[model samples]
Target: MTASRPDIRTFLCRSDNIGVLLRDPATGACAAIDVPEAGPVLAALDETGWTLTDILVTHRHADHIDGIVEVKRRTGAKVTAPAKAGSAIPAVDVAVSEGDMVRVGSLTAVVWETPGHCADHVTYWFEGPRLIFAGDTLFTLGCGRVMEAEPAVLWRSLARFEGLPDETEVYSGHDYVLSNARFARAAEPDNARLVARMEEAERAKAEGRFLVPTTLGEERATNPFVRAAEPSLARSVDLAPGTEPERVFTALRAWKNKF
Candidate 1:
């Protein structure tokens, strides 16, 4: 029998952070990927009328876990966080590592240790639903900053997702698409797809639409950070065609830092 797909709700909190709610409709089991703040998360629960079952945290950043304590207190949700950094997060009940499975009602997510933005960062993937809660490791047109690791280390963390199905839906931690699209266009000015995507992103933001949950295929096509190894992308960024993907990736990230 096919597994049931989880319903997802995307909203903004702390200004630019993207908050996600995953619900198993069959059981009304709901989870919050990260609690940016309590008010929005609590309000979302109230709106959906689904009892919170779990809280999955990606890292130790203040914005990501600020609401965990309050949310847990209010709903008695179990908290799962990266094993390596479990001590830093408040009220963590389960410590998980790469390849571990987390169950939300009948839905299961495999954890991937993707540390680059921070040493404890991890992403959650629900294979049956083709959904990835990318956290801060990967974004629509960019990747997270290399805060606790070298550039190449971060690139390798990102490369882990390359094997996923092209149609996989990716939900990132931030709504940085508009700025990322600008840098992407500059890095590959002649790429028509990036140009068009930038235009579309502008309109979306202008209309107050949130652009989370982009497909992996779309990222592969338009995200310079994801396409670093492509010969055309390397050439656009003034790198040798045969340059190592890691090198290309590092250069692209450095450029984005300044862009």
Candidate 2:
């Protein structure tokens, strides 16, 4: 039997980080993707009247796990973190690795180790609902800065998402659509889809709305980082037309670092 769609609440935490609450309606099992701050997570729980049953940590980054202790203290939620991060993250009840399945009520998410920005980074893919909590691995039109690994490693991590259905909804860790849109346009100036996406991002920012939960199709169409294999992106980075995709990606990432 098909599972019922889960209820999702997306809110701002700290400055630009995103906080999400995923609740299984049938069983009311709620999970917070990451706790950037306890106050916002608590507030969202209060407003929605949903009890947090699990805290799913994406990586060991402080911005993502800073509030884990407090939120766990208050709600007694089970904390699940990357096995690779081990004790670096606080209050972890479960240490999961690649291919592990995490269940919240009837909802199931397969853990995918998508390291690039950091070695311990993981993305939770809820296949049943076609939703991905991409952490810092991917944003709307951009990807996380390569902090712990080579640019090629990040490219490989991003390649994992290309085969997903176009309608899959991606929930990333931060709100960087406007800046990513700007950089994407510079990388692919003549792309009408990118231009349209940039305009939408601008309007979203103006209205104080977030351009998150972006569909995979939208990312494929407009995200330059993911489209590094295209000859145009190679040319934007001053690489030859037939350059290797990985090299093209590296150059694009280098350019984006300064952009």
Candidate 3:
């Protein structure tokens, strides 16, 4: 039998942060992925009438965990946070490490210790639904800034997702497509796919719709950060075609920081 699909809701919270709710329709079990603000999360739950059952945290960042206390208090939902950040986050009912399984009724998500954006960052990969909740680690057309580790470390963390199928839908924590598109265009000016994606980003922004939950295939074809191993990306950064991908990634990230 085919795996049951989830009902997903995406909304904007606290400026650029993206809030997502994943619901298992069969059981009416709903999980909020990283609460940026309790108000938006509560409002979303109210609008959908889906009772909050779980709050899956991705990292220890303030924006990601600020709403956890209030939301958990309001709904009495169990909180699942990164084991590495257990001490830092508030109201965590379960602390998970890499390879751990978290269940929201019939839906199961495997925890991946995707640190680089921060030491405690973890990605929740719901394999059955082909959905990856990569908070602060990967974004639409961009990756998060390397904060607690080197750029190569961030690249290695991103490489972990390469083994997953291209059809997998990536749900990142932020709405940064516009800025990411600008830097992506500069990183690979000659990439036709990148140009097309830029136009799409523009259209989405004009329509007042968030351009998120981008497919892994779309990210692979256009994201310069994810495409750092490509010879064309190396050449665009003034590096030799055969340069190491990690070195190429480092160069691109540096250029983006200053861009």
Give the Å shift of residue 232 in candidate 1: 3.0
Residue 159 displacement (Å), model 2: 0.5
Candidate 2, residue 210: how far the Cα is off, in Å: 0.9
Model 3, C-alpha of 111: deviation from truth (Å)? 0.5
Cα lDDT of candidate 2 equals 0.94
Pitting candidate 1 against candidate 3, the one with the higher lDDT is: 3
Tens-digit lDDT track of model 1 for 1-259: 8777788888999999999999998788889999999999999888888899999999999989999999999999999999989578999999999999998888889999998999999999999899999999999989999999899888998898999999999999999999999889888888888888888888999999867889999999999989998897788768899899998999898888988
Tens digit per residue, CA lDDT, model 3, 1-259: 8867899999999999999999998899999999999999999999999999999999999999899999999999999999999689999989999999999999999999998899999999998989999998899999999999999889999999999999999999999999999999988889898899999999999999877989999999999999998998999889999999999999999998889
Kindly give the number of clashing pairs for every candidate: 0, 0, 0
For candidate 2, lDDT tens digit of each residue in 103-221?
99889999999999999999999999999999999999999999998998999999999889999999999999999899999999999999999999999999999899899999999
Point out where model 3 deviates above 4 Å.
Answer: none
lDDT of 1: 0.91
Every model: Cα RMSD to truth: 1.0, 0.7, 0.7
The lDDT per prediction is 0.91, 0.94, 0.94
Clashing pairs in 1: none
Clashing pairs in 3: none
